[model samples]
Target: MNPYEIKELSPTGVLAEMGVEQGDLLLSINGRSVVDELDIRFLGGEEEILVEIQKPDGEIWELEIEKESDEPLGLHCDGGTLGIRRCRNNCVFCFIDQMPPGMRDTLYIKDDDERLSFLQGNYVTLTNLSEALKRRIVDYHIMPINISIHTTDPELRCKMLGNRFAGSILEDLAFFSEHHIQMNGQIVMCPGYNDGEALKKTLEDVMAFYPWLQSLSVVPVGLSSYREGLPALYPVDAQKAAETLDIIREAQDKMLAQYGVRFVFPSDEFFLLAGQDLPGEDYYGDFSQLENGVGMMTDFKAGLRDALAGRTPKSKGSHRFGIITGVLAKGFMEACAGAIEKVYPGADIGVLPIKNNHFGPSITVSGLVTGGDIVAQIPKENEIETYFIPENMVRYGTEDFLDDMTLGALSQALGAEVAIVPVRGDALAEAVAQRLIGG
Candidate 1:
């Protein structure tokens, strides 16, 4: 069976009640073909739905279900598609191209599919958008499609994306705007290239569409060590990051005055690298550009602080814990550890900062920290009774790090039980409370 094949069902559950069993292929829901996981959610969000199943014996079975509109049919299918569409463009700053050999095959695959943007929150360039595909997107009424629009200058965009046809970013965005498509945009600002004047122009051009452009996130380009033979792109240094934030602040003030919202935001890395303080939580309304690392640390800290309010921290006995994070977020993590220790006056917590040895130091973010780096850095001298690592470091819904190192391997190397802590503040507090206070 293929990766997308339905391989199992929850015992004594919805699928079983409908006579659907393991090995049966999910053909469609409500008579629409199930192309990807997005199709499942879009089609299954109906009170009454018809589902078609293909049995192992080549027979088709049609079943009707009655349930709440948003209820799901319990079926364990493939987490990812085996035959997923690949990206067509070879953009100059493409991260995958900068990766050295000897990694998992999946890491090398570049995907620019729009369905992924709607389903998985992955950004799409819209370079592959055809008239027919555009109509399909509009017909489906996909909301807040995340797009990578480096710049509004079509010719420069073409040069950046390394495709002549890539220059049509604005043309496609205009189409989405005419359709009132809500979109979040990302700009990987390159020095001497898209920043400063070009950025100002791009922001103005995008703001012309008003609310249709939900938010635009300006992020500095990450320069990896493996960028041999690639374009000579310099890293966004302290001065450059500071300058970019200045540009963003000016534009942000103008946008907020005109639209009552900070229509543009720089990613957290900029403020951190520039040695400038991040904006307070209120600046990021609902954090529309959060996934792009814009205002993430601010939101996370605020959430954690709120979660910690009046929540008693208790130390049942003498306990020591190590919380692992990347070098950049070490300060924040140490502060969080201090807050946790406030409740448990007897408990000792150490914030373990791991340098990004796998990726270059420029790529200093907790989410990018590999399991090997943590294992290499977490010293036995810390006497860490237990280790706490962010859930994001591991793959989504799995205990595997980006460099293909599993949590089991990390635990074995560190000689300590690993606790995969949730990124959410409340969930983290609850988990810690259970582990430390209740223990």
Candidate 2:
């Protein structure tokens, strides 16, 4: 890896005061080579620092600065990322493997880099971790690294990830724990493979890590119908969901009695597929696994209630608004629509559940719903001036949908304004009030 050169500089940053310029190559901080963003962030946290920069004219410059420990160095790199380390393991349940050819190139890149885990909340299967990298992570106190430890049993993990070296998940967890590094974990439960007894063993083993393992999310293996010749994996059926839910519930009771926090949580899909009502907010402390869909409904509904408190949108135009969502979130979206509906009784509101034809029905999450499928499946009768679509349906931090279709194109095709609603209570409430109620 090359040294991270300064690609850009904040005009008001400490670096600017130190005469660092754009195109200056960042060589080191306090004799440590500046390789990635993590290095700069970790080393730059010191109260005293030596920054070495190589200018475009091939001149070396050294500058020393004394400042507050937590003060930023005020440098911006491309995405604040060092470099992406692509995933090497061909896991049995790898979602990327199930994707059909000829999609956006970004969708195909599988990243298992720990740097991304610390930066972007992306999970990494410790299979690619080097001893040097591990040391760096521990030394830097990279708190709360998201790890993908599908199973604890060494042999089973190896089989699951299809990499012989993948069996050291427990050892890796032990290392992180020993260094007092906090970690969250994920398990993509592939029904027959990791479910039943295997699931029990994994859970028990993971819980043994205690406060170090912070939390573990158990989500079902999502298999899109595009898998033509991939290995056959069973979807989490009602019985399977119930069985998994039972295990989690039993585990939760024990966890509550011990640590008072349910360390393990099943994804929302499991509860919905099992036809069981989701637990209350108390079951999900801090809502740590909202992205995992653990307490998403609870949090969203709770947020909606909070958003609807006190202020009523007195501006009453009978504006009909529709919410576009996936099958799983239809009910919650309806509830959101209802909140606005109560304000304007005759406001035409509709809930549109767009089936994911791009990845197929098995992929039922809104995030997987493509622009083409949504454009095709949207009911013509469900007409509304503005459609509130979950921001998850579009790419992260971009307007581009999964099918490479921009929100502008979708809006143009539908001839209606599409408002992107974020996956947060306050944002959703604000969007609705501002868009539909014109507040």
Candidate 3:
């Protein structure tokens, strides 16, 4: 059934000004039943439109609208029109494998849809791409797409994706490259599985595509609490982390020297795990992969410095606050908190590292830190007036965390006012400044 029944409509153009009112259901647009907003956007911009409207009283109305190229119909639709696509692959290191059940239903959904990849920058493995879907990507010209290309080796890629169809990633990449379609790639580095020589080979293979491939992100694999039957997956220890860093650093240096660009970046987790400082800001040219945890630390530190620069000290008594983060980011967060405190004296901004009891110790990225894990670590009786959660935890415009717990519920349980800091450096510093200024 069509999810939209426009109650009121005002399209004052060459066509008649007619209203559908509150009891009307939007059946079809230009003879096609709209499945999603994408359909509406795709179909509604034509020179003439035929809308099939259905009344709640079981009557159907055919309304035709003729407008110039620039006119828009004031239409309304249900927010839940878009359906979530579930993932099919059974990869052992999937963070979703570790999630504790019995939360919101949406939390359990494992999405691998390219539509989301195009719309929200979510990464999609090409394993699920049908020929028709591939054609649509080319037809729609979904440029600047993000893909999960953990490895390029056919056999290893098949093993990594746990699907036979996954082995053709190179072919898919070739298709995109041939079409001049820009894309960013992600590798969820599993320690024994794909880290050492495998990672190097994968980088070499993908970087071969050059400018067609925009950037590559190498993030440490996350393990949640729900992995009982999955294959063995281990976290990268300090030694392995250092070795990975060394190998990647050399590769990055060579890439910079040869291509005039650092084609690959290991996420902030690697630097923190290896006890190495983040790369200089200039190393992250344009920060295209920041959302994937690349250059995030550098961006955060720079943001804090600018936000607190030339700022006034706390007006009166102490106002304590805490920012929760994953274990890998503990040191960086502490240093930034200290810097902020230095600028504004008498403000105790503590950096609290929330251990991953939900996803296991292997997962150390901040984006996967659940509310339950955070609530478990942070003390209730602390003098801190408010707790800051990373905005990355929640879907934009929604209170739901990736794990399905609402931020409000977590805040209530913890007895603290929680504010989600925007994922950017500037927004994060501004969040701190606002709290300091009592805003």
Per-residue error (Å), model 1, residue 311: 4.4
Per-residue lDDT for 1-439 in model 1, tens only?
A: 3324687777766777888888788888887777666667777778899988988898888998898976778776775654566788878899999876788898899999888888788898988877966887787788778999999999999888888889888788889999988888999999878988998898888887768878899998887778988888988899989889888888888888887988888999999889988889888888988888888888878877887898665667776778888888888778877877787676688888888878787777788899878877776555777888888898899999988999988888888888898776666566667677673
Q: Return the clash pairs for model 1, or none.
A: 313-343
Better of 1 and 3 by TM-score: 1
Clashes of each: 1, 1, 9
Give candidate 3 misplaced runs (Cα > 4 Å).
1-36, 46-82, 312-317, 400-416
Question: What are the per-residue Cα lDDT tens digits for candidate 2 across 1-439?
Answer: 5667787788899999888888788889999998888888989999999988898898999899898999999997563435588898888888898887899788788999998889889999989899999999988999799999888999988889889999988889999999999999898999878898999988988888879999989999998887777778888899999999988878877888998888999998988899988788887898787877778887877887787788754654566677788887787678777786676465667888887778878787888888888789775455578887888888888998888999999888788888898877667777767765565
Q: Model 3, 219-255: lDDT tens per residue?
A: 8877665778888887777888898888788778878
**Stretch of 10 with least lDDT, candidate 1:** 1-10
Better of 2 and 3 by lDDT: 2
Poorest lDDT segment (10 consecutive residues) of candidate 3? 7-16
* Clash count, candidate 1: 1
Q: What are the C-alpha RMSDs, in order, of all predicted structures?
A: 3.5, 2.1, 3.7
> Model 1 segments beyond 4 Å from truth?
1-82, 311-314
Cα displacement (angstroms), candidate 2, residue 428, comes to 3.5
Clashing pairs in 3: 5-24, 5-25, 7-21, 7-22, 98-224, 98-225, 98-226, 223-359, 224-359
Ranked candidates, highest TM-score first = 2, 1, 3
